[model samples]
Target: MESEKYNADLSRFHGMIENLPCGFFIAQAQKPYRLLYANDEMLRLFDCRDLRDFCRYIEQDVRNIVAVNDRERVEREIGHDLQAKSDRFEHVRSHLFTRESRIRYADISGRLVGTEEFGPVFYCTLQEIDIPQPGQMVDRDIRDYVVGHLDEAIANQWIQVYYQPVIRTLTGELCGMEALARWVDPHVGFLSPAAFIPVLEQVRLIYRLDSFVLEEACRIMRQRMDEGLPITPVSVNLSRYDFDLMDVCQVLEQTRQKYSLPRDFLHVEITESALAQDSAVMHQTIDRLREEGYEVWLDDFGSGYSSLNILKDYNIDLIKLDMGFLRTFTDASRSIVTAVITMAKELGIKTLAEGVETKEHADFLASIGCGRQQGYFYGKPQPIGGTLAHIESEGRGIEPRKWCHYYDVASMFIRQTDRACALFDRYGDGHVHCLYANKTYGEQVHELGYQLQDIEEDLGRPETAEVVRTFWAYVDRSRKSGQMETYFYIDGGDYVNTALQVVCEMNQHLLIYVEIQNLSQSNAGRRQSKLDENLRYLYTMFEDVYLVHI
Candidate 1:
């Protein structure tokens, strides 16, 4: 839209924002950063008596309210936002000192507004966090340290890029790596991304940090090729904040061009929460990013709300399934994972399962045809140069152990193949107990007029001793090798063929899955079995994986 039209639409915006709960203000988009307007809330926020006092106090300079040490970084960030002509709202958190010398931590969100008369202005809001205890106000200290040292860190090379490997699930090939930012401070020692990234984002210093990581990732990819070192496409995380502060596509494109990297040499991972805030704008940005040759991935896909809507509406290259889902490794989680993967697949998008810490999770994902797996099981994220060296010497690391138990196998098979299935737990050299049995398996058990668990006591009987021995032996081997075991047993003069799969969960408990195939010399029974198989696969397919779009 043209500036005049935008101005007409926003003509009432200035007044409308005054009704908002938080502090609101407008200032010159460019330096010397004179305040053009301030709402009553803003006055109260600064502990000013009124507009006149607020104006006279700051001398028209916005920096006066900003703590002295943060002025340079704030200026740099705002300057960049202005130069970029950013249209999106930039959330910048920092300390705004009051007239009474009290410090207030403010989360300031702003965007440049074009006006017919003023040319352009910075329209912003301020939200203050609580005051700290005596001498416990370390937020400012950390903010100062980061902003003060960030430039030097970049120049003197304290900020480093780390690469965590992403493995192809089916073949366990090193498919890709995510570029993580790490700070090895000269005075403070090692600062994980968790430590300084939030501080940087709060202070709106993430642009510098994110840009550095992107360029460095591209450079490392190019350098690795030049050095004959093995390399894969590196994914660099772009903050949702990036869209507000500057033109993310332009920044990334320029960096990619500088490194002369291929279109797919670098990828982008955006968290689900970031996209949820403003789906329309984010969708456009993602589409533009993809159009510019960058593959956009929805990182931590199932970690938030409206995920199904994101998949349906946004055109993304891949979805990184959040590792938190696998923390339970429960039936519901497994079903949900299947649902997500299946949904993504149907939408012509790929799935990358994150946090494959255990061999079980990796194997489960692989068996279900998940495209990629990334977690500590493969390799922890490490420094770029060190990772390159390690990969050169060790190759893409070893294959993850495959541990598919009976339940894992049945969960996959019964849902896909439509075989009658039940689960049982073995006691200390005594009871062979049935925990739960599926519908088809329950039909056979119902014919014997006994509950599933009731069959356990019979396992000790002379007639059932053979089946018990075979089942327990198989359970032991299945747990060790992480593979399924098969055996046949006699129950009431009937031959029941079964496959037992054992899965060891996080709690160190074993779940034994039994798949039963009813074999009899009756055509009617064989026909019934075929019907069960066909109809079961269809029901389980939809049951195991249901697409959720809203």
Candidate 2:
């Protein structure tokens, strides 16, 4: 009796769906998605004569009904929505292929359902909308054109790669460049990246575009090398689809190797939004990229609410400050940018400011110790051919400094402190050059009855000779052990404590950070008395007391 009622209920459900005005169908939940049933409206929407014709046109698979360009995105979105939401219903918009191979814009809604015969399936509704084209091309038209002509665009060189310079704030030299894609169609003239990039992303064809840009950038780098022109790292942006669709790290590595370029020559930039999607995969990809010697930068950082979370979860080499921070250019924005740069420095990550269009913006970013800057203030994005011509006319090209990274890192460290701190480059010849010193360092030197200029310029003064020698000795030990600290007496019976830390060593020169603290005057008398007592006790304890002098 129950079996008969189940059959009757199924029959009633089929009848109700067949009479509905809109298109309705049932499909398997899994891949190859066998189409179990389709209403007459669904057959008409697909331009099919009947149910058998519809099934045959779609190859008995619901997935076949979606246009090739939109299939992956539609499937991914539906699957993700089904897993993430408690509600059984999910909606997605995609372009579907009709029986006559015509593209139709569709709004699809599906609800998960269980049946005795099909086990688990999706009961889906499809609606087709005819979008009108205006004098200017609408988004639907652009998407259609891109979907059909993207491959042709790439092949015919309609897709062009352009580069914008990234300058080191301190040196005002080109430290890097960011590769950007531009579309120039013969039929449509020039198309804004805003118009095409998002469309490509929606259709999940962004990985191909990004790969094209990277390949073009590599070719440019090789050309520059062949011409003996100066070359710096060129950063290439990667879309999230790149990671989802292919082995992103493998692609990058293969491209770098193909051009015989250094791993650092091509930097990987992933936007914050991209990183937030499928963080597990992103984390693994980032790790693999870095492990292969590619510097992975978080592009458009601070553009989203999960910025801090991304920093916490992934190991990033640098962060590109979102241009939104500088768009309005308010005091509040300044404070926020400053705080972000400081925080990144403290976390041992570099920062680059974007949209630095004005002198005020550039000056402010430099004042705040932003490591890098990229904007129209430096140069606009241009093709490689144009860039080389401009450089030739200007008689110089952007060159990378080997020690700039170390210098910038040390400068940021010294600037953030209120203590007497300075950065020094120690040479093998027992001489040191001051790279940078904080205001507190100069004030402390003045308080010690010494001129800051004299201390930095010449340590050969009678009063400073011994101190300099001792400091160099500490520097040497720090180079071997990473850090060293000592307390010593200065000329005015003032005790001072000093620390030496090695930041990096390159070309036989060590970058060291030094901090000095002047002890309180009130403790001098007590310290002197204690020192005399200890000296006397040591002399008495040891029959032969040897003193080592510097």
Candidate 3:
């Protein structure tokens, strides 16, 4: 009873630490700075997976996460604090890497805390300093400073463009990049976008900034091409105000023509929220742009007001799923994502999932069929010079992890099945969450990815809902009976003959396997001709959805 009580107390202690808002860490007061303990937020902030992973990484060196130049200074200061047994250390600006290996800046504070048993330890809290502090208003002086330097900065090359790479999910090939804006003020050092962009936008000077980025991005790509380097398409984001201020197409077309670049070389990305303004003009602009051989992507999708109506009406070439969409792993979120991918596939749209940090996120996305992705897993944004240097240097071998524990069954089957197949975990509801998918099914479903639970999405459409319902019912019954079931459904006039099998793994967990094949064109055509008659035949053919008892 005493031991049980102690264990319960310890569990509560862990819970409290995990719930802390700010990142907290405890490190030994010695060389190599061995990590003793860290809160969940600390792991999250440093982009460490867990305590075991974090300990494995440092191998007794705090410099593993610190910036190269800052390492010596950081170590010296910490050593001083430890030697003197300082009660507390004031805020110190520090550079660190997120679990995704993205570079970030933070204001760190450390306090020397210890007991006889531990000897000495440093407790630290990290507060990221790059973002604006809550309730801290932007000062007028900074605004005026920006306004005063705007013209000179433009002419003297203070504004810079950085390229963040986007890779093909399956092959890890460098497929494209996004052009981001940066400002380097000689007096103030590197000014973040959060600092200068609002000032620019307030003065309606954002167009000038966007134009510079577009031109410079094109020039950089052109230079790389001239150097005999293969260059992929680069996307430049345009503000809603940018579209209103100038002929966006004209600006892009002129830049392309001046560089003699191919039409597909440059891409445009517009935010989903921006779609609400001046719909008619925006529609016409997008239509004209597409006709002129340019691709327009919907940026930051599923962040705000993600209306299916916008997707249905717009002529968008691609949709970039926002990181927030996958921030929380839940059944509902998965279901929604599944539906979104399903609809996007039917509409012939491509998807690129952003903010993919972990191998789990990447594998899940690839299994769903969304193979175009970008995130810290690939690499962080770098200046044009850095990007070029990186390209010239050795390849960073950033590839999607081929296997995952959660989706082990699906991963195993994908390697062997030529036919499209998906592995699902029965959730004991009318729903089953897809765990893995074969490449054939994954790629065929959509260029981006689809969710397995998206089977529920078909229930909404009166056209395909009934057929899907029958299919699920068959699956559900067969799973319960510990057996196999076969069913069929029509996808875009193609008859997908499907077979479902259930297996009990060593863990005593049940896995449902879905195998699918697209019937030959002749067979599909013949089925299409007898669609009405076949609909009647489908119900009777199932014969009350009988299961083949294994």
Best by TM-score: 2
Q: Tell me the whole-model lDDT of each prediction, alpha carbons only.
A: 0.68, 0.74, 0.66
Candidate 3: residue 517 Cα off by (Å): 7.5
User: What are the per-residue Cα lDDT tens digits for candidate 3 across 1-550?
Assistant: 2222322343322223444578776666666566656666767666666666665666545556565555654554454344344467655555665555455566677877664544666667777655435443333356787888887887888877899888765445566789998776555445557657878888888898899999998998789779976677899988877877889889989999999998877889988988856377788888999999998999888777655767877889888886556667677776676566656766767778887766667777776667478875565578866764564463643322222222323323333335777766654333445556677766556532344446535533325666666666776677677777877665555555678877544343456777766653445546666663565467558756332447
Error of 1 at 542 (Å): 41
Query: What's the lDDT of the predicted structure labeled candidate 3?
Result: 0.66
RMSD of each: 18.4, 17.2, 17.3
Cα RMSD, model 3: 17.3
Error of 1 at 197 (Å): 1.2
Best by lDDT: 2
Question: All candidates' TM-scores?
Answer: 0.50, 0.63, 0.54
| Residue clash pairs of candidate 3 | 47-99, 368-449, 368-450, 369-448, 369-449, 370-448, 370-449
Give a tens-digit lDDT track for model 1, residues 1-550.
Answer: 1322332344544544537788877777667877777777878867788777887778878667676655644544454344344453455546566776555666677887776666677788877655445454333355677878999998878988888887765445566789998776655444445557888888887988999988888888788779876567789998888888888888988988888887776789998888877656677788898988788999988778878877767788889997678677899988888877777766767778876766788778855657778876675578866654655565654332232122222233323224567655554455465644556677766664666666667654525566666666777788888887766444564445667777544334456777766554235547567644554466546644222336
Candidate 1 ranges with C-alpha deviation above 4 Å? 1-140, 388-525, 528-550
Q: Count backbone clashes in candidate 2.
A: 0
